[model samples]
Target: MYVAVKGGEKAIDNAHAWLAEERRGDTDVDELSIAQIREQLSLAVNRVMAEGSLYDPDLAALAIKQARGDLIEAIFLIRAYRTTLPRFGYSNPVDTGTMRCDRRISATFKDAPGGQVLGPTFDYTHRLLDFKLAADGDAPHAPVAAPRQEDTPHITEFLKGEDIIQDEVFSDDTPGDLTREPMAFPSNRPLRLQSLTRGDEGFVLGMAYSTQRGYARNHAFVGELRIGKVSVEMDIPELGFAIDIGEVELTECETVNQFQGSKTEPPQFTRGYGLVFGQSERKSIAMALVDRALRWEELGEDNLGAPAQDEEFVLSHADNIQATGFLEHIKLPHYVDFLSELELVRKLRREAEARMAPKEAAE
Candidate 1:
């Protein structure tokens, strides 16, 4: 009766079959199409795009369906799919100044030039359950208006006019992608922002909240938050020109933080910047807060031993995919390591017991 189990291959096959069946769900009912997920579960699709660093809604939707609606799994699918695709070239830095914004608001000011358009938000909705949505439900239609062609000016840029906000020195430097290249220490703004954007929303939120709770308490005022679509262009090196590849939705947040002026510098306000791949305002805002906290050194502020101020700590552990994969991988076979430890403990116990027996007999 001491026979060892030997169904690893069969077990794996059965698991796969079960997963496929679960994903499909209810053979009598129509299979949930990728289009259905994309249109119906758009917020989930957005989360996948934001975290996955890919903007294909359809593919994200398919990933959601295949993942049994697990948002993180959907993001992983998109990320894996994205890694296999060929890259042509980099696009010019997106001018948020000239962005065609669908939604834009500034917290620093009561009113701004571009004007606040509340566009598509669940902010004001009560948490009461809408019972109708328990099943497939029809949504109400809203009046559509022609898209505005006028260029949108950033709220931060307006503050720059009054010297109220620090004007970021723009450079033609092309920052290295963290995904393509291994993340190196002393990361630049672009790399830091990139990591924060794809970072887990809840983790970032907690870290940001920590700053407000007396940890690296840099008084932060939300300068602006914008959600909109922007064209992504890739340069064709062979053709010597850039072509419009596609467009993506982005959430951008800029936070105004207190800055103590240096010897040669004037007393001016500092900024924390955040930008993400989709309409993820919460992530963007959290990212901005944490971004400012991480800049304590550059701003010549004392490190208050805050977790948010520790760049090595925060940036290293920010990615959920990396964290989850490493943490969960330990669930697999480690019997060999366990056996070694077990043997050591048993040997040590026997040696200690044998040594004590002679002393006890003498006593």
Candidate 2:
């Protein structure tokens, strides 16, 4: 019997309660502290912050704990909270040229103006797990370096000197926030980068990998990859000028892509940029490759009908929260639709059986 079920509110409430209980298993055992998660499980928090488009590490860490270690769910929490925040102002772009970098490296040149500092990378670490860490072992301190205030230069500037790199003109005009506004066709560089930074890391990585696998093989060299803190400045109308609001940690990657110069310009290396919220090199690198692939049209290259070149496809499917939520939502009740399909199938079968029986009798 087909019966109408009308307990949507109760079902939702029950689901939420179950989720809360699941999030806090064995209540007698000590609940995970946000600080503990933030300090110990910092990488998870970092991913959340990077994907969430928020900079607060503490909030990201808290969200991680509350979401029961689901990075995407933690990101969703941070994103939702970010919407309620009242933005006082925007920061004047901190010149990366003036950044006090913690880690900076260039694959293009063996040595650049800012010497390559491979600070705190797991690149050379052994894959074997340390059993000691399972018991929450304390980390050791490294020898402290002398504090110095020195401005770091971008590797691209060196190419600029030789006129080998494409000219990058900075505009004093402000860029719109993609999250605040509905994305339109032919997005500007700012919007495109914003969408990519908050995009699904795996999706972006796969799209980038596709380009490498001959979908649209645009040779890319890591012009520069830097991770560090930068001060955010904002203009205060009453103060008549911009002031430093705060500092944020960011992972920025810039790739020099092999692009043939257009008819209007001389041959020079073009740039694909990726800047994310925290220490996420892989995401940033993937973002750079996808960024370059998306620029095929602007670079006067053939579209080649590649998925990477399709802006709508890449941008629409890049957010995991949106994609997963829509995908998982199918788990919700759909008995009415299923019943209708079942009835149609039965009717079709009965008609076929009647036709066959009459033909047999006639024979």
Candidate 3:
């Protein structure tokens, strides 16, 4: 840990005040409200919530506003705020099977049980600027569709029905929480998945992309990608029953990977699962790919020595908050260390010149 020594409290205080005023942009323009940011900048808020590991949109929005749209800074703010919150007992695991899906699609099949519901997405849109937004004009009203009354079953359930895909194994043991306990090496799948879900989006995305480019490549097909709300429940000890505490929107991705069986088992398609707090499909998909890559040992695959496959490597560097602190700390004053190094270099140069002087006289 690096400690930076400093003085000038008045200067620091003045700088902070100026920074706050600067965040207001111009005095002539109207200030942005938290509600406006929560609604208008929904994607940014979602990203902050996902990375911050906090599910509160309002708090995420406030962080974004305070950080002046710097997402990493916003996530840092939310994380700092999260520590003060009171802890309640953990809620029961959410069941994605009963999700009221806003969007659902399966890449493996041309047409699946739940036909693709294309919600608000930029996937198909051409890269073009909307000059209309410049004129302060409202967007055209989006065509409203009737919400489906029935809960949509996961697309993987059909693949599982035929007994083709490998079954997802589960244990009754409670998984470790990284927030509460320090992360240990040789992390279990539960802990790894937990890290990936809350990991930095860019870092995880790059690691996931590496796998696609043949670094421990595991050919994965998006068996199903669904985004919707799932209810969070908590059991009551008094009645041996559970009550619905609340619901949270989530993106769940299940990747089907073709595997050539090892000596211990027969060849069967395996699954990689990714679940996160919000509609973060990119992160979810990346999490799935990296999740699959990291499962090399369990699947009896060779250790390809890839970054994604390294448990400690990925988990250690995945946290943006931690990474930012270490990286940004270097920018703080290190004048004492620099001066010592500078003197050492000068001494070495003088010694080299002294040795060269004798050689020159002899020549």
Candidate 4:
């Protein structure tokens, strides 16, 4: 991260001071509160948390403010800060089936179990900007209703009843954590899911779109998409049981993909799943597509040589922190490397000219 520049430490200090001034902008305007960003610009906060691999919204909001609304920079700050924290223990796996869903929908079936609850979404709204928001007016609170008592069954359950889709087999084995262990290739589904969940939203989105463009097509239907609060549990050694440590907002997506069965199995649909921190519908959907794309071999489908199918490529390039580190490093002066390349090119051109001169004179 060293920049080749004159005036060293004092110059860097002054530059930071200038940056702080720029971040504050006008003196007349009131400073933005962390709570405002957490509540109002919640989507941005969610994105930062998802990419940063941390669940603290207040911290995410603070990072967003400190980074001056640059989400990637905020994520970098959060990640760097997270490295200093002591790890007490890992939380047990969350149960999405019992989620207190705020939003839920399915594209495959018109009316699936628990019905379509279009909680807070901009899907039906006009795309044009409303001048009302500019006038410091907030929308009036809408009427509320009691949450449904009936359990919301997943769309896959119905499909599973008919034996038309592959069943989700739960394994007793503990899933691997990429951060805890050195990431090695030929990874399992859990490790891949972990990478994809925290992967760059734009990168994952592009990979998903590529699959739709017939580059390793896995015709997928949105089986179910739900966003809600799920309890985070941790096993207590003394108690000899798991306890709910906290709750986190999560977005879960399950895609029903077309899978022609192999010799050992029956002709039925396959599944692609995405479960991520916060209400990130786009990220979750993109994750599901890429997840399915990566499962080509396991599902007995031939790899169409797509970018999403390459586990190492997807896993390596998916991380925004790592990606930005590599990308932003080029901003620092490459004086020696550039000068060396310049010299090589000049020497090769001179040699070519000398050979051409002899040829021209002979001619």
Candidate 4 stretches greater than 4 Å from native: 1-7
Cα-based lDDT for every prediction? 0.84, 0.85, 0.90, 0.91
**Which stretch of 10 consecutive residues in model 3 shows the poorest summed lDDT?**
1-10
The best candidate by lDDT is: 4
Worst 10 residues of 4 by lDDT: 1-10
Query: What ranking of all candidate models by lDDT puts the best one first?
Result: 4, 3, 2, 1
Is candidate 1 or 3 superior in TM-score?
A: 3
State in Å the error of residue 181, model 1: 1.8
What is the Å distance of residue 216 in model 3 from its true position? 1.0
lDDT of 2 by residue, 1-363 (tens): 244678688878999999999889998989889899988887788889988888888999999988888888888898899999998767788766666677899999887765778878887889789788778657778666775478777788888889888877878877878777888887877777889999989999999999999998888999999988888888899999888888887888999988777765567898888888778899999999999989877777877999999888898889988897889867767788889999999999999999899889999
Tens digit per residue, CA lDDT, model 3, 304-331: 8998899999999999999999999888
Which stretches of model 3 miss by more than 4 angstroms? 1-6, 137-139, 237-240
lDDT of residue 250 for candidate 1: 83
Off by over 4 Å in 2: 1-5, 8-15, 27-29, 146-148, 262-265, 359-363
> What lDDT does candidate 3 reach at residue 300?
83
**Candidate 1 residue spans exceeding 4 A from truth:** 1-7, 135-137, 144-149, 262-265, 355-363
RMSD of candidate 2 to the true fold?
2.6
lDDT of 1 by residue, 152-221 (tens): 7887777788986678887888787998998889886688888988888888999999999988898888
Query: TM-score for each prediction?
Result: 0.91, 0.91, 0.95, 0.95
Deviation in Å, model 1, residue 225 alpha carbon: 0.6
Per-prediction backbone clash count: 0, 1, 0, 0
